[model samples]
Target: MYTYVLFVHLVAAVMGLGAAFGFPIVAKSAKTVSQAKFVLNLLHKLEVLPKAGSILLLISGIVMGLLETWLFKEVWFIGSIVIYLAVQFIVAGMLPKNMKKQLAALEGVQGEELPEAYLVLGRQSAKLEGISHLAAFVLILLMVFKPF
Candidate 1:
């Protein structure tokens, strides 16, 4: 039923967005080169949760829209969908690329201090992550308030 679908959607959002919101904090905890490398590798592995959650989110959201039918015509619903897709693009396409660059930049570094190249890439990744977080916040607002 609708309630069950809504439940699944909410769970997916939590699983996906919760991991996303935690990423910056996790990444920021690295103080040494080894820590940074370990964190990045761990983050890469942790990406699977959000990826799976995102897929479930999209599927459940579409099913709910189909069930309701009227939601398709709502401004808030449309806006949420748009924002969701944008976040997806950033998460799926941009973030991984940036992470890979960060990892590569860490290669051949010979000190405890983080290199400038890795720092630069980390900053870029953080900015992208910030944008995605903002988009996600807006998406949540739209969903919760339905402020059309």
Candidate 2:
């Protein structure tokens, strides 16, 4: 059972990272309102897939941690879960909000008019995404090493 779960969790992580890499290209190419909406929808769907994966990973992680006695005094184990949750909210909630607001701002403007607002939001998104990647990597390393 744990083996099956670990497999699923790893697969989910790969899929999630793949989606993250692809998002910026799609987002930048969004020109019209419909395009923006479409991209946003796709982004949400993609984001949800990873989120589901993370949940499975977390549930299985906790179970495995206890059953295997790996969680004892493991800061990385705890930190990974906490950081992943934070990133989940940031990506799914804040990132989407930023995208929508930028798109809305674009609606009334012309000629590649992405406002300074988007720059701020984009920077924040990048930071969050970077942190998520790092957390995921740390989690993987800790899982593999199990060095307590």
Candidate 3:
């Protein structure tokens, strides 16, 4: 049972965190306002991967801790939970708001080049995305190594 839960947790991490890493690249690839809007819309749709994966990973992780009993007391586990919650908070809270602002900034524009406001917001969002990815990597390390 623990093995199965662990497998699910790992798979969820890959599905969610893996998809998240692509967001910055995708956001950067847009050459025009329409293209940017389309790409951002696609990103919004793709968010399901991370959202569902994170939720599942959280549930499965808790189940594993309950089953194993010692995991709850481990530093690695506790640290991973803290980082995971932080990443989720950033992903769920920060990214969407940033994206919405970017979109709103673009809403009135009509051109191939994005407005300065949109570009500035895009850079900020990209930075946050990079930070989120870093947090995900740290969580992965903690999970794999279980280092105290």
Candidate 4:
């Protein structure tokens, strides 16, 4: 049972975290406003994969911890949970709002050239997304090493 739950957790992490790492690459490759909008729209549509993975991770993690009964006592486990929740808050709260800002900045703009406002918002969103990815990497390290 533990192994099964752990497997599910690992798969979820790979699915969600892997998708996250791709965002910057896609966002950075946009050469025009239409391209940027298409990328963002595609990202929005594909968000469900990560979101589903996140939900599975939470459920399986809690079950494993409950079965082992070390959720509160283990430092590494506690840290992972905190980091996971923080990442969730950023993903659910910050990222969407940032996306909206980017979209709003691009609104009514047309041409092969991009506007400064859109570029600025894109940079900001990229930074936030980068941080989230970094945090996710940290969480993965913690889970794998259990250094605490």
Model 3, residue 91: distance off in Å is 0.4
What TM-score, over all chains together, does every model reach?
0.97, 0.72, 0.96, 0.94
**Window of ten residues with lowest summed lDDT in model 4:** 103-112
Candidate 4 Cα misplacement greater than 4 A, ranges: none
Name the lDDT value of residue 31 in candidate 4.
81
lDDT (Cα atoms) of all candidates against the true structure: 0.92, 0.68, 0.89, 0.85
Winning model by lDDT: 1
- Give lDDT tens digits, candidate 1, residues 31-141: 889999999999999998899889999999999999999999999998888889878888999999999988888889898899988888889889999999999889889
TM-score of 3: 0.96
State the local distance difference test value for candidate 2: 0.68
> Which scores better on lDDT, 1 or 2?
1
Selected candidate, larger lDDT, 3 vs 4:
3
Clashing pairs for model 4 are none
Q: Which ten-residue region of model 2 has the weakest summed lDDT? A: 110-119
Q: Per-residue lDDT for 1-148 in model 4, tens only?
A: 9899999998998888788778778878888888988888888887887898899999999999988996668899999889999888888788878777777777888666878887887888788898898888898888889998
